[model samples]
Target: KSAVSRVLSGKPTTTPKKKPGSPSKLDERTKRRIVRYMQANIGVTAPSVVASLQLGVSPQTLRRFLNAEGASYASLKTSPPLSDAHKASRVRFAKYHLDNHTDFSTTEWFQGQGVTTTEWPSLSPDLNPIENIWAYLVKQVYGPDKPNITCKAQLRSRLWHAWETMPKAVIGNCVGSMTRRLTQ
Candidate 1:
C-alpha cells in the first residue's frame, strides 16, 4: 500500500484546524439575539426573524453563526420538565384529544419519548424544572412585549435580536435542568 494509504489504515487523528479567512461572519451578539427571540416566543419563525434583523444576512449566515458557536436553534427551544400544572394541562389535553379522536390513546401518548405519566410528582411543583424555566424565560424574553410590541415585523425583529443575544449560560442552565430531572 502507498504510505498515505498505510497511514489511513489505522491511526489516531488530530483535530483539524479551522480554515483561515473563512467568512468572518456573525458575531456572538447576533447569535444570542436569535436564541433570545426563540425563547421570547417559545418558538421562532425563520423568515420573520431574518427580515427583522435587516442585517441583510441569509438564514445560511445565521445558521453558520450558530454552528460556529457549537450550538443550534433547536438546542434553544428544547422541552423543559413538566411541572404539575403543565403536566396536568398536558394530560388533560391528551385525554380530551383521546376522547374526541378514536385513533388516539392516552397511554401511548404518555409513554412516548421524553414523557412518562408515572413520573408525575404530586405536591412537589419544584420537581418540574420546566415550570421554573418558563418563569425565568418569560421575564427575560417576553418582558418587553408587555409594554408594547408595535407590529408583527417589529416584534419579529425584536425577538430575533433578543434570541441572537441570549446568553449561552441561560440556555445551558435550562437544558441542564433536564439532566438533574432524569437522574433523579
Candidate 2:
C-alpha cells in the first residue's frame, strides 16, 4: 500500500522558454552553414563579404550570431601568422645560407638581400585553394546523409579515409581555380 502511494506522487516539471524580445534561436543547420562560410572566408576580413553572401543574413546579424557562437574577428586576424617558434626556425634555417649573406639574422642582412617582411592582412579561407580541398573531403564523406553516423569515431574514420583517397588531379584543379575569383 505504501509503495503504491509513493508511486502516485510526482512533482511537475517545466522547460524554460525564451524571453520576449530575444533574437530567435538559430537552427543547427543555419549555424553549420555560417561556420562553413566563415571557414572558407578566413582570408577576407571584410564585413561586406558576409553581407553579400545574403543567406538571408545581414553582416551585423551574422556578426552577432558568430559572437553568440563564440567566434570573434580576432580569429581571422591572427590566423597562420608566424608564431615565435616559426620565426626562430626561419632565423635558424637562414644560417645555412650565410655564404650568400642573404640571411634574416640582422636587419642589414635582410635589407641587403632585398627581402622584405611585413604583417599579413587578415585572411579569408575562401581565398585559399586548400579550403576547397577540405570542403570537397567533407562533402565526399557526409553528402546528403546516406545514413546517420552513430558516433564521432565512425565519422572521423570516414573523414580520414576520404582525405587519404583524395586525388592529386582534384588538388591541381582547386589550385588552378585560385587564379580566378568565382565570387567576382
Candidate 3:
C-alpha cells in the first residue's frame, strides 16, 4: 500500500504517452506526397484535396494530418462591386492612358481598355496585374519595421506616398507582364 501510494503521488513522467488508436493509414512517403500536392495547389480546401488527390483518406483524417504538418486552409471572401462613380473614374483613367500611349494600340491593348471599367469576377485577381501592384504597394507602405497605420487618413497618406515614390519602371514592368500573363 505504501509503494502504490508513492507511485501514484510521485511526479508524472515527462515522456509522452502513446495515443490510443490505430496507426495512421498514411505512411511518411504518402504524407510527403500529400504535402507536395497541397503546396502545388494553393487555395484548395481539405475535402477538395482529398478528393482530387484520391488519397483514400477521410477528410477529417487528412485535415488532422495536415494540421500536424503545419498546413492551414483559408477561404477567400469575394469583394463587393464598385459604385457607379468608382466605375466612371476607372473608365476615365483607362481612357487617359489609352489616349496618351499611341504605341499601345495592339488588339490585346484594345481588349484591356474595353475591360477597364467593367466589374470582374472576384476570384480572377491572377488575371489582373493591378493586384500585384497593390501587393507591392502594401509591402512598401506597411513593411515589417514600419509603424502601424492607425487611421484612414494615415493609410491614405501612406498609400499616396508609396505610390508617388514607387519607380515608374516597376509599374511599367507590371503592365508589360500582362501579355505574358494572358499568353499563359
Error of 2 at 62 (Å): 49
lDDT of 1 by residue, 5-117 (tens): 75788764556788888565566677678777755765455667778776577877766665765654554546687789998999998866754324446657766755754
lDDT of 2: 0.72
Best by TM-score: 3
Q: Where is model 1 poorest over a 10-residue stretch in terms of lDDT?
A: 116-125
lDDT of each: 0.66, 0.72, 0.83
Clashes of each: 18, 12, 0
Better of 1 and 3 by TM-score: 3
- Model 3, residue 6: distance off in Å is 26
Candidate 3, residues 1-184, lDDT tens digits: the string is: 5666767988554668898999989999989888899889877887898888788989899989989988777776688789999999999988767544345456468678785534344445476678889999999999998999899999999999999999998889999998988787
- How many residue pairs in model 3 have overlapping backbones? 0
**Ranking of all predicted structures according to TM-score, beginning with the best and ending with the worst:** 3, 2, 1
Model 1 reaches what TM-score against the true structure?
Answer: 0.29
TM-score per model over all chains = 0.29, 0.32, 0.33
What is the C-alpha RMSD, rounded to one decimal, of candidate 2? Answer: 27.4
Q: Model 2, stretches more than 4 Å misplaced?
A: 1-125, 182-184
Model 3 segments more than 4 A misplaced: 1-19, 77-184
